[model samples]
Target chain A: MTINASKDLYAAVPDEQGRFGPYGGKFVSETLMAALAELEVVYSNLSTDKHFQQELDHDLQHYVGRPSPLYEAKRWSDSIGGARIYLKREDLNHTGAHKVNNTVGQALLAKHMGKKRVIAETGAGQHGVATATIAARLGLDCVVFMGETDIQRQALNVYRMKLLGAEVVSVTSGSRTLKDAMNEAMRDWVTNVDNTFYIIGTVAGPHPYPMLVRDFQCVIGREARAQSLAQTGRLPDALVACVGGGSNAIGLFHPFLHDESVAMYGVEAGGHGISTNQHAAPLTAGTPGVLHGNRTYLMQDSDGQIMDTHSISAGLDYPGVGPEHSWLKDIGRVNYVVANDDEALRAFHKLTKIEGIMPALETSHALAYAETLAATMTPEQTIIVNLSGRGDKDILTVAEIDGIVV
Target chain B: MSRIAGRFQQLAAQRRTALIPYIVAGDPSQDATVPLMHRMVESGADIIELGVPFSDPMSEGPVIQQAHERALANGMCLSRVLELVQEFRKSDDTTPLLLMGYANPVMYMGYKAFADAASAAGLDALITVDIPPEEVDDINAQLQRVDMDNIFLVAPTTPEERISRIAAGASGFIYYVSLKGVTGAGHLDMEEVTQRLAAIRRHSQLPLAVGFGIKDADSARAVAAVADGVVVGSALVNAMAQTLADGGNSGQAIEAVASLLGEIRQGIDSAAS
Candidate 1:
């Protein structure tokens, strides 16, 4: 589906108040307002500073492995018999995921702000590992909050964070998942606002966070736009990425948002199914509400109590999506769909065996939807799927599912 | 004047600081809230800040967070909290009651609808912690339409410019979070609070009520010396939790909480003298 590019969609968004058309705003306690304002000002200045840009670009290229390849999955595409599938290889980046891109940027911002400590909330622990990696490099103290359930599921990443000299706090409150860890992180930031900077993992949270994280992660789309033209002679027909707070998806979609000919899809984790009401597809099955400092699509009851979400992939098991995705959904600019646990597992194994590439279960959700979408298009059409992370961290989860002790 | 403003005026006239006590509705049990409110008022609570239970109360420490969990387990909700207000009003309409919680519940019930329903239920003010000054305009407008006051929090980290802005927009009284952490998580730094309260006073003439870490009678007395009102939350909730854990019935729990409030009230009165 083509959009009308006559209007400049990018220039009008997240107005001065940080609102994405009534979706995104600083819906946090008074204690956080000043810090958010300070961040907004500092980011606006440093985002354009020549020296800061050079430093960030240098770090991206040398440290985090920027310009990850756009490899065409010919065998997988031929086996499926449809659109030519190309994977934006973010899994090849340092720390093995797209998460490092934003972390590297935010860690630099933290250093520039003269903060001595940094804190982050993680689900699936990929973000925690990435944050720890950068903080170790920068010689800043790091604390990562992970839910107890996630700590058990992603032990490897937790140990990796510890080995990197970061403290991992186990959050045992409300649902024992991503949302609770975020709550703990917010509390910590509120308390330590003076000496610590919070490095949020997704395109969510209050103002400047969604904007800054998106800006940092947009490298994915920028590189993909250029790579598609250079390799395939033109931009791909479609872009696909999974939406857990929608960082990876937005990173791959934002640069192409105004490209009228490019269709974009954000896949949400469907734990059981929408019918069973046990999924985390807020954009697909939830309503607009405030949570974790922003107004966004949330999985909540009628009484406004946030509901517990379920997903095989810990990364996608959140009750709310980023507010920008809420805006994108409202404007019909992106199609938000769902892939269930079983389907994601199928895609996880399919890519691992068929292409010798093991995709993170979170990324497998996107691959699941991509397979269905690819089956409908002609071979001439090309689809770019964001391989968000490597599946190495998910080995334990997969093994446990198969009832194996290992 | 609204009930909240009138009460503050009366307290100022008597040179007595207002004693505000916060409790989660239906914490011990759904049937226990209205009685607790009445008991608190009798025990010398000038204003009642009833917590509307939310699944995620991020601003609360573990003490109040557990209270919210217990309340939710007892099936408390926004509508029920309003119903409790109406129930409390049935016996005594003089003591001002305010709903204190997060913003999502109010957002769930449309702003106008919530304002109308809450005002009709005899609520005097609203304190949704997560809705800061920048985002309170629309909801504040709705509350104004219903003649209800939209209260705001002034934190220790709040700058003077933002404080003035918040003071300009806020009605009723301004709530001063005395520490840099979540509710019930920090020790009261009396000097810092006094300094911040003095700073906030320069920006607004409205009465300032201080909360967060005003736990026992001693802490309440210390804060009362510098502010127009002293608000206690986790201590009262903890008292009730202890009563329930010790196998005390809801009545005993109410008695325990009321006893603590009475001591706090005495502390405030003693500070005034």
Candidate 2:
């Protein structure tokens, strides 16, 4: 059973303390309590404050170029020959991804809160670049915590962030990946709470974070809804987006939660396969536990220590999904699925060749699933896939696999 | 009176500040834990803050983090930590022992079960690093039933209004992290510590045990002059680690740890005296 369509998504969730059923809670250090408490107040006041909304609207229109097009993938749709496919091209955003949406909102929030610096944790580097872009625009000091592994793999994005004038800290702890970077970022936030604002890149972390990030990114779903209705004369039959800490997916699916006729899909990274114990699909195969500030689905061993997750896409390498996603999954509001590394690679090639859009490896997971789902539906049906980011940063990664010199 | 209260009373009567040494439960070796604890007491440690190793410790810096990795590498679990406490309790019941770590392991054992087991093991107090006052009152209620004190940490970032609320659920003592950074960090601001502890004193009468950033005997003495207790973690843990690469025996490791504790103990006593 998915979340009830009758209940308002905003009214039903995260109460005052940032909880979604039993999922989201302030599972953070005592040092961060005051900062989070103050943030809650600031976010609440500014969310309704007309001036803040105007500034955000101005940035969305002119700065990041919002209202990203709903493009019909005619060639790609015809090849599948089942459903008409449309793409909400988030890849066209300022940082070439949907990640900039949340960053812009949080950077604005930081400005409102009187914080002079912003810090973020990133895995795939899209969120880092996004945060760096906003911090540069707002003239706030920026620091991005990236795992040692990710810094090595995503060197181009690292250079881009540095070129944007953001200091990048390499996290060397715990498997040296996204989760470790998250821990380091939290440590930095806890230590530097007075003058710095931690802009979490995902729709996860502690309470207000899941709610706030979802609220900010919901701009995606809001625009897509109006555009889809205008262009297609009705709502799309299905909505699909890849889940990695689930910001982009939740951004697309949240507004459509009340749409009973629309089927929602959240595609997660399946590194090799689920049975191989090398994937990051926590909602699909994980137990509920606390990590990175919220209690949600996690990939952990029996003794409760978090397990290392494997995924070709660094963005989806985390072992936990957003708590709201976990809640929605439990309530059956969203169908959580997976696209393996091979399938995602195939979709990357297919989308690039067919649609002339080189999608991020993270977004390729959505494209992979949408292809299969489209094959099952009749041509009368319609599907909207959130092409979360452009794949330029992943060119070297893809080229390495193809054994070609770039 | 509780063991923690009695110790504080005894220390107050002696006009001396308490010296609390912290260690990861099974760091050097599981079998060596009880002996190292006993050795610490002999070296003038007034209390023990035994770490229950967690996979993720968000607030801890590199030193304690590495200590946890070594302990978990030896397959140390929460039950093993309780067993060590029980073993330590068999020989010594007077010294108060506080189990310090994050909340996940305790959450894994149910609150009631964890409280019961800890009380049975003679753990006098517990400090869950992640829990704040609002989220922990329920667990504190259960812990209180077992006569176990839930010690809360009042960090430098902790707001003044929140301190009284944090102190309300507090027992044993309130740990005041001396710096804004994590465990093992240097840069102890003696003036800042004096000012913050004075502010904390206005909100809390709970004996304040200052920790974090107290690296040496001099810093411990400086902090002890202001607060009721001084906790030295990373420096002592770092001492034990300095010998690990050379394949040093537990005896050598314990000697290094106890030696540092002795100096800090002397530092506090000399300051108070």
Candidate 3:
């Protein structure tokens, strides 16, 4: 059974040192200490600046196409007791995912800071593609590191990034996937800090990055709040989104977190089931530890070495989640759940056949959970699902599983 | 404060460039690395970067990766590497020691503990191969709280704006990759290194050390003419590899590499003079 949410969801571990429940703290060589201190100052200043917010808002609205619409799914809603359902169309954003919302904003910050190049790491290539798209727009040189294994899987996205004028580096390292890509990108950023800006894709990484990316993505919630209120006269009962690094989910859930009436569910990628070793559900079956810069729940071995996570959805292949989501789960602001591969596949086909919308496999996980949710709830309840990205990239994946031709 | 940074500032005030050297630690083992680092310091190394081995080094060339693989096989992790540094610290605490490695093991060990142990082990700085300058403090606050230099890398392909941002976040010395590719690639544009280093220096006063292709005394001396320091890795590793291939004592191979490093440092020092 899930424990009651703690009043102080965030347990103190490191005092005044930014440690997260004994999971976070700065561990680095002395050479980079002053740089961290300086970064802390710059980040704190940027966070409080109204002008920065306005500038980001202007870009998000016009350049990246903000205020994505919420569509009421009449057909899907009817099948599930005719309950009213709304879909937050973050999948419609430029670059075909909600990642652009944060990348464009962060790249703009880099430009404002007088930085010229942008760098990032990607697992499913959504973040890399998004970062590359913004770098092209800003006329900045961009580099994206992807795991060598992922390069073979998501080759189409790699080509798309190259087309966007971003250099895609194949990182052939440990596990040869997302984690290795992260390592390579980090190395590149450290090596090229002189004129480079790292656009972290998720709500992971260090404090300022997690906070900064969340703030940028908060547009999803800000707009969803206004749109939901206007369309339904109130907020939805449940907010559902897949939790691959927890960016899109947090984007929608952050604003609604404080609203007591709203319940949030984050669907993690459970490849087979929670019982199997092959799952990406870190919070449910994993422990609190560090991975990819932030101290959070990670799928790791007892020795604390990061474990290679498995997920049918390439985007949800990460072994860790955003630290904020971890805190939110602990505090009962959100309920973290898992959707298996078969369930996700069923949802993918259901949405594709019923609504004629083939969503990204990552989004299918949320839809799968929604299916279970709708069966138990009455028609009066409303569910707002975050369609994080389009399924164009996953055509090959779905085809292989379904035995369809390319 | 980085020894190279102080020296570079002095050189900047007097219109001079600095000289640096790079080596993969535990390449042959402590028998060679301990003395080799000392010899590099003695010869004329303004700063020395000691690479900690990992299972996979993405940015490194075949030569350097081989060296890393060998070192890993020789049982070199963060603790062992620090022990190597501690051994070197007995005679040369002032020569800045930069421990460059991946973040997994370091993060696994705990950030605060790693920082405390590294600081106590007498490390002057760190340059994680896969950590962005902005995210350095995520590991442990002590990396900055203890006033250690977090060196940043500046590559030939880096843009002006990024250079400024990295420079702003950089302390210790700024490492400038001499080429666009990984280490051990026999190609380098010395002119490009000079130009990129100059471009990076415009945004930062930190020492600019060039690496990735300076494999020999000649190449090291050439890069040192325009850069604050020269880093030689693959060439040294290659020489050591050759010795190991010959069934020669691995420690002797390290000594031989150190002797070559000393030659390169002397050559650069003479050229500067």
Using TM-score as the measure, the top candidate is 1
Clash count of each predicted structure = 0, 5, 36
* Model 1 per-residue lDDT tens digits across residues A1-406: 2444655666677888898987999989999988999999999999999999999999999998888999999999999999999999999999999999999999999999999899999999999999999999999999999999999999999999999999999999899999999999999999999999999999999997999999999999999999999999988999999998999999999999888899999999999998999999999999999999899999999999999999999999999999999998888889999999999999999999999999999999999999999999999999999999999999888888878996
- Which of candidates 1 and 2 reaches a greater lDDT? 1
Deviating ranges (above 4 Å) for candidate 2? A1-3
Candidate 3 lDDT at B132 equals: 57
lDDT of 3 at B46: 61
DockQ scores for all the models shown? 0.89, 0.65, 0.11
Residue pairs with backbone atoms closer than 3 Å in model 2 (clashes): A1-A331, A1-A332, A2-A331, A2-A332, A2-A333
Candidate 3 chain A least-lDDT 10 residues? A6-15
Report the number of the highest-DockQ candidate. 1
User: Which residue pairs show collisions in model 1?
Assistant: none
lDDT of 3 by residue, A26-52 (tens): 433222334445566776687688998
Q: TM-scores, in order shown?
A: 0.99, 0.97, 0.70
Model 3 has an lDDT value of 0.77
Name the Cα RMSD for model 3.
Answer: 7.5
The full ranking of all candidates by DockQ, starting with the best, is: 1, 2, 3
What local lDDT score does residue A365 receive in model 2, on the 0 to 100 scale?
A: 98
Best by lDDT: 1
Off by over 4 Å in 1: A1-4
